[model samples]
Target: MKKDIHIPVVEDVYIAIVNEYNAIYKTQDWNAYIINNKAVDLELVLIVTSGYSKKKATSVFRKKLDKLPKQSYAKIELMQEELFALNNTFKVTFFEGNQMFDKTYLFRENTINLKALQSIPLMAVKGVLAK
Candidate 1:
C-alpha cells in the first residue's frame, strides 16, 4: 500500500495594496500591506521585492512577519525613493502548517492601480481592508 501525504496550501492571501503618504519633511512615503483572507494562520511570512526597473531589479524591501492571523494584515513601509518608480513587483512567501506558499504581485495589477495612487490625497489613509 502507498501512503499519500497531504500538503497544506495558502489561498486567498495576497499583497493587497501599496499606499502612498505625505511625510513631514515635505516628501512622500509608501506602505505595502499584505492581507490574509483565509481561515488558517500564516507563520514566518517574508515579503521581498525589487524596485521598478526595466534594466535590473533592486531590493527595495525585505522583512519577515512573525505571524498573520486570519482575516488580518501586515504592513511594510517602503523608502521614499522607491515610491517614485512604478514598475516593480512584490514576492510574498509564508508557511501555513508546514506548507510553504509563495506568490508575486505586480504594482500595476488590479490590486494596486497606478492612476488611483497618483490621485490619492496627501494625507489620505487608504488600505486594502477598506476596499
Candidate 2:
C-alpha cells in the first residue's frame, strides 16, 4: 500500500540567510528569507524554524504567507550572530495548485558566515543557501 502513494519532489524553492546592512542601526545583520523560484504561485505558505546544539536550543518560530508569487521572495526572520554557532532548521510547506509540497532546510553549525556566501536567486545580495 505504501508503494501506491506518490510523493512529489520539491524544486526551485530555497531558504537563504543573507547579511544585510541595517540602515537604522548602522550595522550588518543576518536575515533569513524564503525564495520561490518556481514558475507557479505558492499558496498558504507556512514555515517553522528553530536552532539547537548539544546543550542549547532556541524557541521555535512560525510564519505564514497567504501567497508567494512566482519568482518572488519573502523575509522570514532576523538571525542573530550568536545563533550561527548552532544548527538552524527551517521547515517550509506550501501548495502549488492542488498539490502540496514541503522541504526541510538545514544550516549546519558555523556554516552561515560571510565566507560561505554566494549569489542567491531573486535577491540583490549574496547569501548562504540552506541544504
Candidate 3:
C-alpha cells in the first residue's frame, strides 16, 4: 500500500521575508509573503507560521486563502525584528484540482538579514527566501 500511495511534490511556491519601509511606522519592517509561481491556481490555501528557539517560542499564526491565482503573491504576516533570533517556520498546504500538496519552509535563526537579500520571484523587491 505504501508503494501505491502518491504524495505530490510542491513546486514553484515560496515563502519570502521582505524588508520594506512601513509608511505608517516610518521604519524598516520585515513582512512575510506567499508566492505562487505555478501556472495553475491554488485552492483552499492554508499556512501556519511560528518561530522558536531552545528556550522560547513565539505564538503560532494561521492564515488562509480561498484561491490564489497563478504567478501572484500575498502578504502573510509582519515579522518583528526580534523574531529574527529564532528559527522561523512556515508550513503551507493547498490543493490543485483534486490533488493536495504540502511543504514546509524554514529560516534558521539569524538567517533573515539584509546580507541574504535576493531578487525574489513574483515580487519586485529583494528579500530573503525560506529554504
Candidate 1: which stretches are off by over 4 Å? 1-10, 18-29, 55-57, 79-84, 109-114, 117-131
Q: lDDT for model 1, please.
A: 0.62
| Model 1 Cα lDDT, one tens digit per residue, 26-129 | 65445667778778888999988766555645656788999988777667654343344545567888998878887776664233444454322222455332
The 10 consecutive residues of candidate 2 with the worst lDDT sum are 5-14
For candidate 1, which ten residues in a row score worst on lDDT?
A: 121-130
Question: Pick by TM-score: which candidate is best?
Answer: 2
* Global Cα RMSD, each model: 5.8, 0.7, 0.8
> Distance (Å) between predicted and true CA of 105, model 3?
0.5
Clashing pairs in 2: none
Number of the candidate with higher lDDT, 1 or 3: 3
Tell me the whole-model lDDT of each prediction, alpha carbons only: 0.62, 0.96, 0.96
